[model samples]
Target: MTANTGFLERTFKLSERKTDPKTEFLAGLTTFMTMSYILAVNPNMLAEAGMDRGGVFTGTILASIIAMLIMGFFANLPFALSAGMGLNAFFTYTVVLTMGHPWSYALTAVFLEGIIFIILSFFKVREKIFFAIPTSLKNAVSVGIGLFITLIGLTSSGLIVANDATFLSLGELTSRTSVVAIFSLILMAILTAKNVKGALLYGIIAGTVLALILGVTSLPQGTVFSLPPSISEVAFKLHWDNIFTLDMFSVMFTFLFVDLFDTVGTLTGVATKANLIEEDGNLPGVGRALLADAIGTVSGALLGTSTVTTFVESASGVAEGGRTGLTALSCAFFFFISLFLFPLFSIIPAQATSAALIMVGLFMITPITNIDLEDFTESVPAFLTMVTMPFAYSIAEGISVGMITYVVMKLCTGKHKEVSPIMYVLAIIFAIRYLRPILPF
Candidate 1:
């Protein structure tokens, strides 16, 4: 065997997936194409809360590289990690601006959250929680996240429009962008039906080209290569003053709650989609994934960015037949290379990624068949999970609702013996989240 091939086989067991280095590379590129928008969007958002745009930009990319590598090497899974979307908004707007906390204090809170996560992960508390979840709900989480991803893709591609009456309506298909996205979806469906290897990746590239040609999206104008911005302005700038104060307690708890549920939901959803969950519903190497996420969050705070978490966009790579960590490793390399080639990332229109995400979302739906519909106790909660994910616009929210409903159904049906202790704990936590707004404490 050749040296590179031998190394890949030994490290990632690429043979298990029947995927070669080239396929892994393409899958990685496909994942990056879909997620690279964060490289721009995160900085702009954080800047509104008093962060340096350039520093946040640099920190975002660097943290992604580190986290992705750790996930690749430690978890041996095809997941990618980066600064999360909603959490960053909370970090900037709610924590820093609204709460009147300094940006440094926000970073310190994130740092504390990360340390807490590390401790939890090391003791396998996070992994145990995964195991404690009922199999029916685990399957529901997977299907729920799938619907959530589809919602994101459709809205992002302008195939769906916001409305006052129904909350959502059909977009103008006559619009060039929506039309192009429709065509892209059909093309990807055809490729997948034809059993094309890396069909998702191929579709994304083709869709981007088609969008560019049809004037559905404008090409980015900038230098193709440039030096990365410096992170020194914000790096290692956390302030721990009053960290133990009551005010900081709420800030830290908020960070911990959101991060924990988000990570759990993402991991469970992605593992189910990729078929990485054990027959017993346990996710192998999950501790590593959790550790990678916690380390990423900590490093992001030190390097000057918001909390980092596993990207749901990694499902796009899995849909492209990426069954090993080589995909994540390859993606990490692209994140580093992107420091110079970032302008190219902008040229990939949202329609292309939306197409891929929508298709991957479709692939993740098969797990729903595993739910026992005859059992009302299982079916109702499962249905709640599937619908609430998209309607609520949050995977974690869907999971919370599902678990809460699951526990309620069990107790009401006198199936309390079926409910694990962790389920009760989660229900209480979800209760606290709901009560947060009204609690005078």
Candidate 2:
């Protein structure tokens, strides 16, 4: 295969290239519902950053479908890739809204970061980076993301409140949002436990209907779901001027490292769960998967969104026993169909998606058993990461605190010799990112 060969030839199919069409369709439906939440939100995030709202939305649909196809046909990773959730929030609310950085600058940062990802992946440095991460921390990160995602669902669904008077807030049991979320949560659990086909899809469907009854749709023809003309509007505007900022390196560095580990961690966690990895402890065709993911990030940025990566919802697909590339190909096709069904997504309110997000959050917790809490050295950092993520309302913050604690604890315990050299390097990088002041200029 040539260096520029498409995603397929890069990853080989070791098993038979056949699967049941019905099973694949069900898997595809499951993947689609899991990702439906992002269709509207990702575009909305990039638009706030001054990007073409239409282009980003179009990009969200295009890149997601394309990426999922690559994952399906090439990598067979049983995962869907798209503009990541936290990355969008970080780009919009944190970098743009909070830091007052120009949206263009943040995007420029994403572009540079994507290039870096591709370079690291092509050169095959991902394994070195992964080696630096302690297996204990890997377990912690997988579980932490689960906890953090749960919080996102709670806040998105309005089940939880933010009180200015009260320092902390919890679920408001009397709230209708709470009732819906709890109800959906129960439904999802029952379906999952019973091994129902497309249980998550059914759960999300129930949630959306619930949202309609609660007036969350806010659309005229509640049952008729179709894309509005504006859904295809190309919206990205290149701010080449923002590319010259001195802060580009700082911002890009953050994104590059964050995405690198995040992708690897997600792959490891999911691969472990699915038993898709070989006896060598490597997921078969993982290199190709990483390349596909890096390509997705690069393409996503060019399309006008954040760096794309494999979603955790791939866990749901895997849990459903989707072993072949057909499941992913089916998912890709449905995502493309969604471009014309924007009205459908637009009608499914955040609260309903929130129920599904909460389900994904629960689904992600399957890796908790991977951690060995018997050792205080490993347990402390892992515990800190798992607890801090939701409390801090940020995954990065949780990871940063975990890295510092992991390094500092190892050093103090005189077991610093046991820590990987890459971890030490990561500790410094994370330290610099943490110490840097958030300048609004």
Report the number of the highest-lDDT candidate.
Answer: 1
Clashing pairs in 1: none
Q: What is the lDDT of residue 109 in candidate 1?
A: 90
Model 1 ranges off by over 4 Å? 435-441
Tens-digit per-residue lDDT, 9-47, candidate 1: 999888775778887887788788789889988999889
> Least lDDT summed over 10 consecutive residues: which range in candidate 2?
5-14
Candidate 2 local Cα displacement, residue 269, angstroms: 3.5
Model 2 per-residue lDDT tens digits across residues 1-441: 444333333342424433345666676777777667788778777777776676777787777777777787777767778888878888888778887888766766777787777788788777666546676776787678778777877887777778888854776765766666777777888998897877767777787787678765555455555553342334353356755665666667767767776677677656665666554445666776787788787777666678788786666666565666667777888788877777766666666556766777776677678777787888899889888878986666677788888999899989999787878887887777667687342
TM-score of each: 0.95, 0.83
Clash list (residue pairs), candidate 2: 52-235, 52-236, 55-235
- Model 1, residue 272: what's the lDDT? 88
**RMSD (Cα, Å) of model 1:** 1.8
